[model samples]
Target: MASTIRVRATSSGETTEVQVLIQHPMDSGFVKDAKGETIPPHFIRELTFEYDGKNVFIADWGAAVSKDPYVKFSFKGGKKGDDLKISWIDNKGETDTTTAKIQ
Candidate 1:
């Protein structure tokens, strides 16, 4: 199956810029479904990005975050052709991970 995480990492000699997009429902439990039942809380609890065996970025999120969240940040050191690992875990214990090559 295809990963729910999409990431792009670009290195510019001294820094690496990272962008991520995650596909999720992010239900806050306050909204009702078509049947008027609560949707329940379902959102990403944490997101991690690793490079060279170390974490470069981490995000702690909650239901206040919108569906299909997008994030962008820059790190101190990275090189082209290296791999960046991205992963996330939702409130329901579901997880998805992906590796992106620096460009």
Candidate 2:
């Protein structure tokens, strides 16, 4: 779907702070279009964040989530040069995956 995702990570002592932005339509199906037709539901259902091949965070989303959702999280034991992978699956069966290195 060519979705755009941005990730940022930083380490401080034993904790690493991570932030991510995902671009999506996130239609709730309850919404109406210009023709007053109900829009089909489309939203990210599952999101996972992995640190150096280990799960650091996970999210189960709903239609109520806004478009271009932004997420923030912090985890212990993340160091510089570690890999942070972010992946999501949408209700439409589309998926997006990205990775970032902690700075």
Candidate 3:
């Protein structure tokens, strides 16, 4: 499966807020194919966010989540031009990561 992640951050004086959008097909094995074959469970298992090498947020997800999930959150200790990193791992043992800097 293909995934896409977008990150945006805003600064207000000494504080910063970040927003993230993630796209993925959170498939559950309960569904059956046209031929009545059981589909394998495939979903994101973990997600992590960091700012300037400091861990900020982490989440553990399950198959109950919907496809193309989008999450928005904010934290302190962020400044303009600081690097923000986001990463995720899927049940299939695949991993993906992306980084963006506050502007």
**Judged by lDDT, which candidate is best?**
1
Query: For candidate 1, lDDT tens digit of each residue in 8-95?
Result: 8999999999999889998998999899999899999999999999999999998999999999999998999999999999999999
Superposed model 1: Cα runs more than 4 Å off = none
Q: Give lDDT tens digits, candidate 2, residues 9-56.
A: 999968999998899888998999999999999999999998877888
Residue 54 local lDDT, model 1: 96
Which has the better TM-score: candidate 2, or candidate 3?
Answer: 2
What candidate 3 gets wrong by more than 4 Å, as runs, is 1-3
lDDT of each: 0.94, 0.89, 0.83
What TM value does model 2 have?
0.93
lDDT string, candidate 3, 1-103, tens digits = 4437788877775777778777877888899999999889999999899887788889899998888777777887688887888999999997888888887
Candidate ordering by lDDT (highest first): 1, 2, 3
lDDT of 3: 0.83
